[model samples]
Every structure is written in C-alpha cells, then in structure tokens.
Target chain A: MAMLDVTPQANGTAPQAARKPRSHARMAWTAFMAILRRDIVVTARDFIPFLLQVLVQPLFFLFIFGKVLPNLANSGTSSGFGNTFTVLLLPGIVALTSFTTALQGVTLPLVLDLGFAREIDDRLQSPLPVSLVAVEKVVFAAMRGIIGGTVIFPLAYLILGNSFQVRTDAIPQLIGTLVLVAMAGATVGLTIGTLVKPEQISLLFALILTPLLFTGCTYYNWSGLSSIKWFQIVTLFNPLTYGSEGLRKFMMPPITVTTPAGPQSFTIPTLDAQWIFLGLGVAIVAFFLIGLQTFRRRVVS
Target chain B: MAQLTDNAIEVIDLVKHYPKAPVNAVDGVSFTARRGEIFGLLGPNGAGKTTTIGVLTTSVVPTSGKALIMGHDVTADPIGTKQLIAIVPQQSNLDRSLRARDILTFHAAYHGVPRRERNARADALLAEMGLADRAKEKLTRYSGGMGQRLMIARALMHSPAVLFLDEPTNNLDPQSRLFLWERIQQMNREGLTILLTTHDMLEADQLCQRIAIMDHGKVLALDTPDELKKIIPGGTSLELRVALPQPALVSATGTAREESGLLTALRALPGADKVDEIAADPNDPAQEGITRYRLYGQDAGTLTAPALQAVSANGGELRDLHLARPSLEDVFIYLTGRNLR
Candidate 1:
C-alpha cells in the first residue's frame, strides 16, 4: 500500500478527481452569485429613486394610519380607546410595504424586458439553467422585501410611539413571517410578470392587483371576519391574507374567541410555531417552483 | 462534457413547421460552417432565414432534422449548444436599465465566466467594439447603432465558438452599416465563426465567404457571389446606357444604311460583329430627349469600343455609356424571377 501510494503522480490524480467535482460545484455557485449580483446592482442603481418613492409611500401610510386615523378616531389624544390602532395597523403596513417593494421586482420592467425589451433573453441563454435566473429574481425580491420591511417597521414604531405593541420575544417569528410574505409576493409577481404582456401591464395593476389589495386582509384580522364565513374562505385563496394574518399574530395582542371548539384561536402558539413556519415555508417553496417553471417557459417560448 | 470542434455549425436538412401552416417554415436547409468563416444566409423576407437561424440557435425547435454546434446536436444537447453560441436577434434586445458594459459582463458571467474574468472580458469586448467611451451609459441612452454594437459586444464576451447575427445591421444607416461590417469582418478574421442572415444581397456579396440564398423556405442558390452570378440565364449581363432613348442606335461605319434616322443593324458587317439593337431608351438616362439603343453580342468586346468610336466619329454624341458585369441581384432575379424585397 505504501509503495503504490508513494508516487506523487498517483496521489495528484486521486485529489484531482475529488477536486474536480468540488470545483465544479464552486463554479456553479459563483455563476449563481453573478446572477444575484447583476440583479442587485440593477436594483441598487434604481434603488435610490425607488427607495425615495417607497419610503414616501410607507411614511404617508404611517402618517395616515398611525397619526391621522388614531387622532381622528380618539380626538387627537390617541391614548384613549385602547390606542391599539398603531399595533393593529403595524402588520398591515409591513405586509403592504413588502408587497409594494416585491411588486416592482417583477412588474412593468420585468414584463417589458420579457415581452418587449427581451433583456431576459440574455439571461436565458446563459450556461446556467433558466430556473436559476428566475430564482435569482426571487432572491433579489426577497432582499428588497426584507429591506423594505426593516425600514418600515422601525419607522412605523417611531411614528406610532407606544400605540403599537410588538412582542419582543416574537422577533424571530416576525422575521420568518416577513421572509415568507416577501416570497409569496415575489412569486406572484414573477408569475404575473410572465403572464402579462408589456402593453397590458397597466391593466394588470388596475384590474388584478388593485382588487387583490382592496380585498386583502390588510385592514382586519382573519378572526375579526367571524360573521362572513364565505368571505373568510374566499380570502384564504389570497396569499396576502395569510401573510397579513401571520404577521398580525406576531405583532398584535392575542385575540381569543369562544367557538364550538371552546377558545378557538388563530395565533401560532409558541410550541406550534414550527407548524406556521412549515406552512409558510411550504407555500413559499410551492409558489417559487410554480413561478420558476412559468418563468422558464416564458423565457424559452 | 461535450467538446467544441473545428466545424462551428452543422445543420442537416433542418425543418421547422408552425402549428397552422400548411408547409414548414424552414424546409430541409443544410449547411456546414467552418470554425472561423463569415457565412451569410441571404434571402428575401419570409425565406425561412430567421426560422432556420432560430432553430439552430435553440430559440425554436426544428420539426425534423438536426443542427449541431461543435459536434453537439442542438436538440439533444441544448445547454451545451447554447453555451457555444450566441444569437443577436434582428430586434434590439438590450437591457435598458443596465449600463452598457454590464450587458457584456452579465452575458459573460451567464456563460460561466468567473467573476475575476467577467469585468476584464467585458471591458475588452466593449473596447474592441469601440464602445468603451459609453460603457457606463445605460442602454436607454444609446442610439440604434451603439445599441447594435453593444449587442455584438455582448454576444462575443464569452468568446463563443459561433456567433449568430440575424440581420445585425438591418435598419442601420450607411455609416453604421459599414462600421459594423468592418468589425464583423475583423471578428471573423480573428478566428470566430459567424453565421449572419440578411436580405441585403450587397452585404452578403461583400462579406460572406459563402452565401445561401433562400426564398419561400427553399434554397434558391448557394455559392460564392461570383459563382452565383454565373448561374444567371446569360453568362454575362451587359447594361449599356445611351443618353438617347429606350435603345441605342447602331449603324455600320462603312456599309450600313439608315432610313429616317433609324440605323439598320445591317446583319454581319465587314468591320464589326453582330450588333443586336437600336431603339429608344427603356430607361431615359438624360434630359437630352435623344433616342438610344442596346446591343447584345456573344462577344461584346468584338463591337463595344469600335461601336463607341464609330458613333462618336459619325457626329452622334455618345452622351452616356456604361458596361457592368451581372450582380447577385441579376442572379436572384434569374433564379426567383423576383426582387428579394
């Protein structure tokens, strides 16, 4: 064994074989990162103006819901009547902000580039499979989503000032919720981005997205819609509802209701958090796969 | 891993049929392109030029037959085929949001260029295409010619084995066209195989080492420009411009007779050979209002210079005279009986 293995040439060949596969994997990772970098750079270049617009919108919403609505509702005192408006709307703002940021990640520019500009053609022709490009889009959207969420959360807090009560211990849960919410929006964005022609993008926002946003559970909790069973069931079809509900559960006070099951609940109990995370994870993964496939076909065809 | 070889492109009877069409869009077109040749697929509109290129580039599937790049069948090994080729479509498809150089770098990285090499390659390609000055400008700011140049640079960034240019300068101005053609020629000469398609026959004549002219999904002719020109009905085409009218007047210097200013061909002459025509100009060449005639001879040299000297010496002004060899257009008309347009 010693004589056979002693040769430098034999030892070199053995390592080379092992090294090839590992290096190949590394090379693939590098390609993936290049795609990610390209997206982020483009996103960042436009990030300044986009962030200005994004920050303004959330700030406006914060002013409206956090300051104006509470003041108008509680006679400028906002302290009385439970001052829960801030906490109630915090999660909604989070979802809305993330959703808006995620929407751009896959909207007019993406659609125009796919259908008209054909910029995606370059990416599709890459040695990496088309699915990787699609995934990178989601990753870019997720990064922007997290950034939007992080930016809006503290601002929402600073503006609300004691009106909102976000449980400190549930920070991990909030992070998980934001991640999933961003993913859901990004996937829907990718799917819709591929579906709509560039000329029809305005109609997409006017018709589909506007209606979804209006009916989404952005203003109220799933538990609050007790009387409207059918409406609640219908809302379940929307990923936004789940996003908002999961987010609210992590932010607002735990609302308990007495039902036939006695003390039925919507909150993800500490011990059962994994189930919520799992559900969110599954939804993200499923939408991602569907979006990935749709994007690939759209690019190829 | 599939390996790239000397023949950059090999298509064998490639056919592509759309869903509702009664016939294939591309019907049984075949050709082999060497590794570093500038090959042109010349054809009229709807001649399956785009369809054939789309199939070869993997943008569309062939209904039947096979196209291989670097020895890998496009249908069987799409990713490998794609990795070795880049297609610059007839349309401008630049990423408007990105800076000019980013297009090249992004494309290079997409083809698996490492991060360390991407920037340098992108810069080199842009510089090679004379686009370094505008590298930081977004595509939205670039003009059509700059955009087209950038597209070429992007395609070459990965140093693809073959580059497919589908009408690379279709809508460009004359200056831009000449610029791009020179760059394209340089690229081919630098050892990159180029497969270009264009309806402009002159471009094909000037640039292509070999060209295939197609029409209605059929290969009308395939050869060098000179060879294709020889296929025209007449061995040589002679366009003689006479300032007069439809045809030039012809009379023998010594023995011909003219009645009412009409010169008679007067058959086999002693001093000259068979002169075919004397009529008004088919295409009026000048404002002289003078009538002209055309001549056809098995040997034009037998009578051309002598006839011109004789006409000038005989007090008739030889206002306009031109002789040209047949062009690819002549061959195209001879073969297809129509203009490519």
Candidate 2:
C-alpha cells in the first residue's frame, strides 16, 4: 500500500511574545485609508479613459447647443440670444458632467466587481466592517465627480469663448454648489450601484438616466417651468434639476435682452441657496444609509 | 501578555445553508488543526470543503455553530480573526488592474503592515514565490500558474499565523504543482499552520499531516493516510486472469468450473480471505475469452500456486497473475461506495 507518513512535530517552538492589539479605531482608520489610496491610484493610472468618459458628452453639448446652434441661427451679441443661451447651457454641462461621472464611477465597476469579476472580494476581506467598503467606494466616486466638474469648467469656457462668464462675487456660491452637487452625485451613485443588477444596467440608461437628463432643468430654469404648471411640480422630484438650477444661479451671468419695452432683464428663478444645500445634505445622508445597508447585506450573505 | 494556543483552528459543528438551496453546503462539520501542522480537508467537488474554508476564513457567514482561529471566535471578533489568518481562495480574485508588486503591497497595507516595511516585504515575498522577474507586470497578462503564485505571495504578506489554501493546485501543471508543494512545505516548517482542501488523494497523502475525508457535505473519515488505507477489507490484493472457452464446461479434473466454484476455491486458499470476480466488458476484444478474479488477503505469494492450479483444474487456462497493494483510492471506494474523483 502507498503509505502517507506524517509525524506530528512537537509544538515546542516558543510562540512570539504577544503584542498589544491595536485599538479598533486606529485599525479601522488605517484600513480605510489604504482602501481609499488604492482606489485613487488605480483611477489615476487609467486617467485618460476616465477623463474621456467625463468630458465627451459635455464637450459635444457645449459645442452643439452653446456655440454652433447660436452662431448658425445668427443669434449672437447682435441678437442677445447667443450669450443668453451660453449662460444657460454652461451650468447644465457642469452638472451633467459631475452626475454622469460619479454615477459611472461607482456603478460600472461595482456591477463588474459584484458580478463576474469578483475583484471586490479582496477589498471585502479587509479587516474592517463590510459597510466601510461601500463608503470607500462612495468617497472615491465623489472625488471623481469633483474632478469631472473642474475639468469640464475650463472646457466649457474654451468651447463657448467670450459667451460664458464667472462673476467674482458669485465665486463662493459656485464653489459651495459644486461641492454639494458632487456629494449628491456620489450618494445617488452609491444607492443605484448597489440596487441594480448587472443585467439591468442597460435599463438604467433607458428608464432612469434618460428621464433625469430631459427633466433635469438643463435647458430651462425652474422658474421658466412655472409657465407649465404640471412640469414645474413634476421636475421638483428630479434631483438633477436642483443641481442644474444651483449651478445656473451661481456660475452664469445675468441675462439681459433688447426688447420693444426698452432694455429688459431676465433672471432665472432658482431655489434659495440654503434650500439647495439642505436638500443635498439630506439626500447624501439618506442615500448613504440606504446604500450602506444594501451593500452590507449583499457582501455578508 | 496573552498566551499562544496550541490549536491553530477549531471548528465546532459548523453549518452553512444557502437561503434557497435544498440542503446545507456544510452540514455539522467539525475538525481541529494543531499549530505548526499542515492539515487537509479532502473531498470531491461540492463536498463542502470550500464552504468549510469559507466560513473559517470569515468570507462566508455560517448559519449556526462556531469557528475559532488562533483562539478568537470568527463570529464574535471577525476583524481580530481576520487579522490572524489569510486565505488563498480557489478563484483568481486579485485585482487585474494592479501590477503584481502592487497587489502584494496593497494586501500588506490592508493588513496594517507598517508603510516602511511594505515594499521590502512585497519584494521579498515576490522573490520567494519566484515572481520577482514579473513583479512589474499587470495581473491581466499573467498566466494561470503565475496568478496562483501571486495569490500565495499576497496571502503571506501579513505573516499570518494560519493560512488557508482552497485547492491551491487545481489547475497547475505537474512542475508548478511540485514547486507549490515544496514552497508550502517550507512555509509549514517555518511555523505557519496551514489548512488546505483538495480532492486529489495523492496530494493530501503527500502534504497533509492529518486529513479529514469529506463527502456529501459531511466528514466520512478522519485520520492519517496510512491508517485510513488500513480500513479496507484487506491490505493486499491478488489479480488473476484466466482464459475460458464460450459455454464453459467443468475442469479437466472434473471438478466444479463456474465463476462461483473458482471464487470459493480461491477463498479456501491460505492467506486469502475475500475473493470476487471482476466484471468485464462482453464486447471487449481483449477480454472476449478471459475471466478475471481478484482475491484480497495478507500474502499473495503463498496463494499464487494454488490459485493458478485451481483455475487450470477448472478447465480454464491461466493467462496472467499479479499482486498489488491497496491504495487510498481503493479505501475511498470502500468507504463511500463511490470514486473519490
């Protein structure tokens, strides 16, 4: 018979002197930072593709609607329409850029990680609560959203030369609105990323994203929608509408037009800055809690 | 200072049931591995070996029961338990986007290895696993064997007290398998306790200090390989090939000549305890005019003469004879009434 000879060795090797266990707070912090840094490095290495994903659609929108259409229709400084349209379109592009970049950042990789690739298993095994992994993903997505906004802001100006302007007085509001919008983008990304199945991802573009873009107050302001009563009520539920309106109020120049009734000024109606900030803060907390719960359940089970 | 425990792993009646599955993946399984020993859980696929490892590693939660790693309950203190052990899962779960060196470095960082030592340890581990040359390559470009080696290197980043390998050699070539085996043995000698799961009996025999044979979600047997092999009916076997004519008649000496008569005579021989006729294919050309018999007992040499004579007297021509030692495969067949793989 083929014999298996395995003699048990003495357990006599002196165990290394036991060291004090690190405090839970310190360990958790270390693990969290490590995960965050890894994600940032991976994103940085593949930056070109990431940059392209963030810039492509916004660039096309700025070129076509903000520049080409206005010039082609012969509506420029002479008609006062070209500059008005550019002011309206620039903020919309920034909001859309932040929204889509954050959404794709979290959802695309999440679907792949949770589905066939299972690359997330390594992160799941870290010595931290599983919920923290989901939070780290949100943090990274939010950072990407902010980066997307910064990249697109300069590109918007390049595309709509001399049409778009940033008022020095509104700079603080612009910065605050951008930060809140990025946070909202990340929280929404986290929720949708965890809730949707890989197979159902295409449906997200059709059912969720299409509606968000059309009703998102990108081409029109919330006050302009008041002329259409039902739409004014309906668009309130779309989170992107608030983001677009907030950017419009903070980043664009005031619209002035030449009319039969002398020089008339039109200001797009927007929610109070306090209300926008409050709404975004509430959304961030709500989606984060929901995403964390769903992520924890999926990972543990 | 806390004292070290002798047992590296202790699983107690662990059970894991998928929410909608008909049966438990792991059903009331229990075992222990002493510190500094390489223990194996041997089973065919779907025999709960991976599930057992999953629960012990805290990747999969158990429905009930408890598992302790290095004296910390996995459920009660999962992070503490996770800090104490590392696993090389069966699948290639490494981040494909990261370079080979980055994979190891990231693992070390996650496990709280000091930042100053992380790069040096990653280089040393890659070198030890024979992967230093390819350390800068992306994981997407790695071969299956290379990926498996990287996984092993990554798992050792923390210098874990216990290491779990779930079918580490599943798809490895012979040379790679042997290399991995040697590396595993070296790690064990250096005082790392290992718990590995594999269906290959020979692998378990070669690497395990003790094994728990599992089947159908439960452990069927647990012992050293030598002792498990001894559980078979007899330690040795005698195989005999006899040529017989169609519509066979009695032997030339006029004694009984059927398969039953031959089996009885073989059993009556000294040192022969159990005798059986092995079934053969009726359509096989090589076996068309032959009969095969197997006798299980202590010594085949002593029974060789009488066995051949018995066949000849029964009007059958003695074609071939051989004595063989029973293997772990035979023992598994005897225990489960099925093949191990």
Candidate 3:
C-alpha cells in the first residue's frame, strides 16, 4: 500500500455505560460538530442570498425612514433632525435585522425538516442525544445573529454620516449584548420552529415574525412611547424590545441633555440596562427549554 | 461463511397505538434476528412493519413491550442503540441540501467516523454503489434508483452492525430492484445483519433468509421461506373468482358459489389442499357480483389445469384466475388475512 489507512470503525458502546464517560463526551462533541459543519456548508452555499436578505430590509429602513423622510421633514435641508433620527433608528434597525435573521434561520429550515423533508431523522439517528441536536440548531442560528448584528455597523456609519454615536468605551458591553440578543432571538426561532406545524408554516412566519417586528419597538424607541402607556408596558413583554434597548444602552452615549444646571449627564432614563439583560436572559432560558421539549416530542414520537 | 453470533435485534410483545386509534399499529409483535441473518418483515399495507422498524431504528417509541438492539434497550439507551443501527426510510429523507459527496461525509461525521477516513470510506461505498462518477452532482440530478443507492451507501457509512431497509425497492424499476437485491445480499454476506420490510411476496421470498409475515399489526407467521411454505396446508396458492349465470348473492350460504361441490371437487384432486371461499371485494368492478375462492396446493403448476376443469364441471364460469408462487403471499393467505382485494 502507498499509504497507511485507518479503518472506519465505530465505538459501539451503551449510552448508559458509566465506565467510559470521557470517550462518550468526545463522541458527543464529534457528532455535534459534524452537524454544525454540515449546517455551515449548507448555509455558506446560499451565502449571497442570505446576506442580501439580512441587509436589504434594514438598509431600506435606514435609508427611507431615517434618511429620506427626515430630510423631507426638515424641508430638504442637510443638517437637522436627520442626524438624531438616524442615531435613534440605527440600534432598532440593527436589532430588528439581526434578530429576524436568527429567528428565520432556525424556524424556516426546522419546519421544513420536521414537516416535509424529514431530514432531521438523520440527526436523530446519529450517535448523539436528540436534545443536543435541537441545541446545535439554536447555536448556529445565534452565530448568524451575531454576524448579522456586526455586519450592520459599517453600513450604519456609511448611511448616517456623522450622526452615528457608538461610544468607543462600550465595546465590551456591545459585544456581550450582541451575543446575548442573538441567542435570545435564535431561541425564539427554535421555539417557533418546533411549535408550528409544517402545513401551517407560511401562516406561522406571518403570524409570529411580522408581529414581533412591529411590536418589538423596532420602528420606535421604548422610552419614546410615553404617550402610549399601555403600549409601552406591552412592548416591555417583547424580547426584541430588550434587544434594541440593550444595544442602545451599550452603543449610544449615556443620557446627555442641556439643562438649567450646566450640561446634565447623570440620570439613565426608564429603559434601564439591568431590565434589558433580565428580559433577554429570561427569553434565552424560557424559549430554549420550550423549543427543546417540543423538538424531542416531534422527533421521537 | 459468516459466524452467527448473538441476537442483533430482539423485539418482544411490541405494541404501538396512536392516540384515539381503534387498534394498535403493532400489536404484540415479537421476533429476533441472530447476528448476520438477513431478516425481513413481510406484510401488506398497514401491517405495522414500518412501525415495527420505526421502533427498532429509534424513530418511534413503543407504546409497550421491550425492544433491544444488541442487548441495548432502544427506549432507555437510544443513543447506544442508534450506534448499532441505521435505517433507509421508505420516503426520500436524504439531505436535499447537500450533494452526494457531502451527504456521505456529513453522515459519516454524524456517526463519529474518523475525519481522515470519512472520504475514503464514502468514496469506496459510492464506488461500490456505482455512484462515484456522480458524487459531485446535486441530489435532485440523481434518478430514483441512484438516490436509493446513495441512501444505502449512506446507511453503511457508519458500518452499523444492523441496517434497516424500509421498503427499499418500493418504487424502483425492475432492473434497479434486482440490482438492490444483489447489493443487499452482498452486504449480508459481509457479516452485516440486515432487517428489511416489504409487501412484495417475491422480494421477501427471494432475499430474506428468515421472514416474518405480518398483517393487521401482527406477525402472522415467521420462519425460513421453505419452512414457512411447508407449514401452510399446501405451498402454492391458487385463487380464482367464478361468476355464476344467476344472482350469486341469492343465498348467503356464507357464499352462493360454495353451494356447489366445486370446493369438494378441487379438494378431492391430487396435489390439492383444503379450499377456502373468500368473499369477493364489492368495490372491485371486475371481481364484483362474484365469489372468489383460494385453493392451496402442493404444486400450482400441476393443479391449475385440473382446478379449472373442476370449476367448469361444477357449472361455474371462471371469470379470473391467479396462480401465486410459493412466496410470502402464499404464506400470508394460508395464515389467514383478508383476500388480496
């Protein structure tokens, strides 16, 4: 033989075998990464269309509502409310786009795999736990969310000109919030994917994702909705509301307004940083548990 | 010759009933395959063969009863059981997202196949399946037969101790069916235990070393094909429907066709076993308004001529006649199921 060949042998051990936990862990990790590799290859194959999908909606929203409409409101003038409006709009738009990417990335394929194609059967048949299979999906979707969130920053700077107010000091906070928000969004997708029936998948996206974007405080800030008291409270229940607010908490400059007592920078307003983290934390835990349960139900039975 | 080891699959008193369903899908079905045996579950539609295979492959949970794959309980240690078995489903469940090459590679990865050896094993299996030339093509480009071949190759990627083929030849052409049959036999010869489900009588008889004939969610008979044939009153089955000149339903003597001694006439002949009258399907336009009877015989080739003469001698007109070989269907009908309506 020209080269040495390693045989294709499987470690046919019992799952309940307590003697070899180390080998079992390695096998589980190997299977998990294999599924991840497959997902990456498949996603990368459609990279262009996916990239365009994530960018197009937010790009247009930033352009039309933040750029064109503000300029028109300011009577076609250059320097006015456009700057403030873009700064306020940028965080929400980015949150909306990235979260929506995570949600759809997990939900659409999950519905198809469970409902029509039955491709998930292969993973269920793999030498790993079914719950781990579901977790891998959320993990991959969250990764996309992080990427989608990061890719928007340069675009925001380009469109908003000098109006972009990303505080350089808050880089760590921004990275942390970005990852957490992505995880929250991906978990929500996992929940929706498992809950929705394949036949009603079209209705599922329209009923869930659309309402999420509209009511998620994506188009407006939660603090700005003072007049609508009930609506503000309701938006607090929405996870994406926290995502937008969290990004704003980290990225935007901390409460600065001109007051009678010199320049005031003391009070952080009603949308507290602590509450945003709490809401996202709850979403990640609650949705993942629910999604994992339903996913096991659908696959095993 | 391959060494026959301990049981590769052991399913006992298995029962699976969907919620609110009138009957159990798999009712008290029990069987075991010794290592390296080419075992089969042969049945008509709704026989619960698929469900039985489903439980074994970890895709379905049993309502009750125990199933062990190589002494590992499927429900308790499913991951352990999964490491031992792989199923080629009845439906096209291959990853449509990947090419043939990626599908094989991904499946190898899923089973924890070594990274370095993944491509080599996949390449060898593809070449064995005669699909190496088209490994880069999209799955949609492959024909039904080629897709099935790829699935079989993928199932073997892990070199599972037991492989499941759920109606592997269901929609395949004759040439492809023969090709797959040969492949299945080759795999079995290499010391890989195989379990397959099918409704085709000829398939079960030809391929399976030991067959379990199932119907109505139960295994009606299980044995080697020859032994199963020997257990029947006669090995060959002769089924024929006769249309009388008058109203056949005039008397419900269970059937008007049985009022004559045509049943006795056929049973009296040499090479003939007891004759049973099966109610003709009311929905079948060709066989409607007539009474059908099945005559089990030692040799259908010898009994066919005399049996046709006997039908005519009893003043009955033979509308249609079918001589089924000593296959799974003969064992199926002999063990008592609804007529092949």
Candidate 4:
C-alpha cells in the first residue's frame, strides 16, 4: 500500500508547554454547557410542537375544571363553590403540567436516544464523566418544565377570569416553590428516564404516569384528602402531591364551605411549607444521584 | 508508556465478554498501530472487529486486560483516551434534528474547541466532505451517502490524533465508496492514524498498510496484503474450464478417464504444487455440465502448457482459462477454512 509522507513525527507533537490540562471541573462544566446548548437549539427548532405539548394538558385542565365545571355549578345554585374550586385547581394544573412535561421531555428523548436513534452516543463520547450526560439531560428538562409552568400560568387567568386568585403576600414563597417544584419534576424525570426501556414507555404512561397524576393532588388539595385516610397516606408517596400542595398554598386564597352545623372556612392543606420545600430538595438530590448512577452503568456497559 | 509515544493505539490481551454470552466477542486480541499508519481489522461479521474497536475507543470496557490510546489507559483514563480519538461508528448516529453544519460545530464545542475556531473548522470539514451545499439542511434531509459523509466530517471536527472508522463504507454506492476511500487516503497522508474495520478484502488490500484478519473472535493472520497473500499454499493459480461428463478414471497408457487424465497431466507440470476441482456456481443452471479445475503452483506460465495439453489429449475442449495471483481473500480462506465474505 502507498504510504503518506506527511509529518513523520511520532505522537504528533509534544503536549504544548503553554497549554495546561484543564481541571476536571472545567471539562465537566464545558461538556454540560455544550450539551445544554445543543439540546436547547434542537428544542427551539421544534418549538411549536414543544409548546403545544407543554400547553395542551394545562389548557385542557383549565378549560374543563376551571371554566366548564364552575359554570355548570353556578347555573344550579350560584354556590361560589365553582369559583373556589377553580382557584384550588389552578395551582394543581401548574404543578401537574410542569411535572408531566418535564418527565415526558426527559423520558421520551432518552428512550429514543438510547434505542433506535443512539443519538446520545455522540454526547457519550465527550470528555466529561459519563454520568454528567444524564445530569445535563435532567437540568435541561427542568428548565423546560419551568418554561412550561410559566406559559401555563397566564392562560388560567385568561380562561377562568375572576375565578383564579394570586396571594400577593405569598409571591416570594410562590416563586421559590415553583423553582423547587420544577427541579423536582426534572429529578423525577431523570430517574424514570434512566430506569425505563424504550419498549416499556407505553407502560410508563399507563401504569406510572396515570396514577401519579390522579393521586398527585392535581384535582383536590391534600387537606381535603383527610376524609379518605388510606388515599391521603398513599398519595403522600407521589412527589407531584408536594408540588401541587405547595403551589396551592402559595397561589390561592382560603375557601369557605358551609357544613350542616354552620359555615366554616378551610384552606388547601399546607402539609407545612417547610416540609414541602425540604421534601422537594431531598427528592431532587436523591433522584439525581440515582439517575446518574443508572445512566453511567448503562452507557459504560 | 514508551510504546504509547510511538504508537497511536495498543491493545494487550484485550477481551470482552457480554453478560451471559457463551463466548467472548473479542477474545484475547492484541495489536499496535504506529502513529502515521492506516491499520485495518479485516474480518467477516461477528468476527470481533467492532468489539475490538469499541474497546480501543473506550466505548466498551474490556472484561480483562488493557487497551491504551495515545499513552492513556482506556479504563483508567477514558476521558483522556476519548480526547485523543474519535470514532465514525458503523451506523449513522448523527442528530437528525440538527443541520449538517451544527452537528460538526456542536461536536467541536464538546471537545473544547474555541468558539471562533469551532465555526471555522466545521465549515472547513463540511467543504472537505463535499457537504458544503447541505450544511444548512437538517440531517433528516440527507441521502444515505450524504449522511455518511456528514458523519465523517463530524468525527474529524476535533482533529483527533487517531480516528476509528467502523465499517465506514458499508452501504455506499460505488462512487460514494471511491470518494470516501480517496478522502481516507488523503487524511492518512496528512498524518492522522486510522484504525479501520471492514469485511471488504479489496478495501483492506488497497488502503491498509497492514491488516489483521480476524475470525471467530481471534486474529487468524496479521501482515501486509502482499505478505498475507504469500501465506496461502501457492503464490499463483491456473483455472481451466472444460466440457464435462467425461470419464472419471485415468489410465497411464492414454486410455485414461478424462478427469484423472487432466489432473495427472497438470500435476506432472514443472511448477504445479497442488490441484483441485473448483465448485460450480450452485445458482447457475449452465454450470451443471461444466467442469472447472484449479492448479496451484509457483508460476502459472509454467503450468499452462501442460494443463492445455492434458485437455487436448483427453478429447475434452478447454473453453476458458485464467491465471491469478493469490489475493487477500485467498489467504483469508486458507487461514480460516472459509471465505472472508
């Protein structure tokens, strides 16, 4: 065979004296940013579909529970229960949209990336630790969740006018809750995304997602679940319940209901603001670690 | 470490056995490629070529033993190994949503190329791969060959020290394959060490400076193409096609059977070493009544005259005759007892 007579120098050249090897932290950060940028660009190019996916469920919930049900109830007794239900349901919609969107954003892409497409192979070749690729996916998905939640917020007021109320005094806490809830959404997405096979995706939605949404305090506040003691305990295992309750506590005003004995007032269960924030923080770390470990195992092997 | 400075890749006793697999996919394989040479792993499917590349490229950790790329142990310092090498995988794994140019640019950025240099390098690579026209088009819009060229461009975005091309020309049309071959040769000329895996014997013969022929998870033979060809029984072969249905037995006194008569005459030639009947094409109906014979010898010219004389004496008409030098395919068959393809 013909041989090339290019530079016959071996090892190409000596490592440049002026160029120091990058610290591990720097390399990891660069890889993270590059992957994040690529994913964002891809997502932006498909923005219309992404926006539709994020908005569809929240809009559907707002139109049905926030607008239709309340109108249907008002036509009967002018009970004001319709208005109160709308206020309570608004926060749940935001939380549910954020969590489910985040989960789908991570899981579906991951399934495709790891299975037929193998697009993640490109990112796996990066100089960063293999686990960091999983973390990057989680981080980006969380950002999408936050974006989805932000977009859904205004539509609630537009569709359920004069029904939804924002507790201005709790605005600071609300913003914090939103951020924590978004992170939790992403963390759960990462964990489930890494655990699932492409073939099991349909089962994921059927078995896992459907249950999480219904029992996740999306329809009723956790405080109201006290009547069904077993359900209250079981729903506590769902991370979305914390986010939903947290959003309700910060986003809505107290609702008064008349009992047979007398008129009484109750608010959506707080589950305590401290515990909600703490649970979200812990879940974020725990799920992230698990996802990272699983991702590294899958990619390396 | 010292060997690593001179060699772009080194594998020592590398083995990889998937969980529950009955046998190792890459079993105890070892080879080394110099910094400027194009080394090939030529083998049939399931011959462990891709698995070996996977181990050297740090994608699959070995079950035992070690592999190093540019002096960094792959298992101990995979990031360092990855930094020194890039792989053009057998399949098109490029992001379908991204445009051709963005794929290169993003890959460069991931490898730590400066932003300004990333765009410039990506453009240069796109132009080099003949993909400048499609730079702005999404990969989903690219034809198979175009997607392949784009993948080659992406793999070179970072200008890695060593490039691993796994079946790079598998599904290309003739023109695309030739284009890629010329491009690969040009890259090697510019001093990039390449490790290629292909089941194409002709491809290995034309492009590789040295090749390791593997089969059934083991290296059957490793040498330059000419040297490998020399490993077969004889350096040349004379093939004769004759009319069939002649007598099977041969007598020494000219009343011999046609088949034995021809064999005796050819074996009595000056340079004839071995003689055998060539199998007819099973799918060709015309092949049923025709007899083909191959005479392996040191020189085809020396055996030609006697081979022709034998056919004439036996009253068998010689329809066609061809002489060929031993090729890599022949050598592969000799070593593995099966055709390479």
Please write out the lDDT profile of model 4 over residues B1-118, one tens digit for every residue. 4433998888898889999999999988988988889999999999999889888877788999888787788899887777778899999999877888899899978888778867
Across A243-297, the per-residue lDDT of candidate 1 in tens digits comes to 7777777877654445566765344222134544665567677777777777767
Name the lDDT value of residue A69 in candidate 2: 84
Candidate 2 per-residue C-alpha lDDT over A91-209 given as tens digits, one digit per residue, 9 for 90 to 100: 88888788778777887888777866888888778788778888889888888988998898789778878776765678888877877777777878887878888899899889977
Can you give the TM-score per candidate against the true fold? 0.79, 0.85, 0.89, 0.87
Computed on C-alpha atoms, the DockQ of candidate 1 is: 0.19
Candidate 2 vs candidate 4: the lDDT winner is 4
- Cα RMSD (angstroms) for every candidate in the order listed: 10.2, 6.5, 4.8, 5.5
Best candidate according to TM-score: 3
**Residue-wise lDDT of candidate 2 within B3-91, one digit each (tens)?**
27789899999999999999999999999999989999998899999989888878789999889888888888778777778889888
Note the DockQ of each predicted structure: 0.19, 0.27, 0.37, 0.30
Q: Where does candidate 3 chain A have its weakest 10-residue lDDT segment?
A: A1-10
Worst 10 residues of 2 chain B by lDDT: B248-257
lDDT of 4 by residue, A148-233 (tens): 88888688878877776878888888888887788888888877877889999899989888998998888998888888999999
B-chain TM-scores per prediction: 0.77, 0.81, 0.86, 0.84
- Candidate with best DockQ: 3
Between 1 and 2, whose lDDT is larger? 2
Question: Relative to the true structure, how large is the alpha-carbon lDDT of every model?
Answer: 0.70, 0.80, 0.81, 0.81
Range of the 10 consecutive residues with the lowest summed lDDT in candidate 1 chain B: B253-262
Local accuracy of candidate 1 as per-residue lDDT tens digits, B234-283:
45433343332223244443223331232343233233322333334336
lDDT of 1 at A195: 76
Candidate 2, residue B83: Cα displacement in angstroms equals 1.1
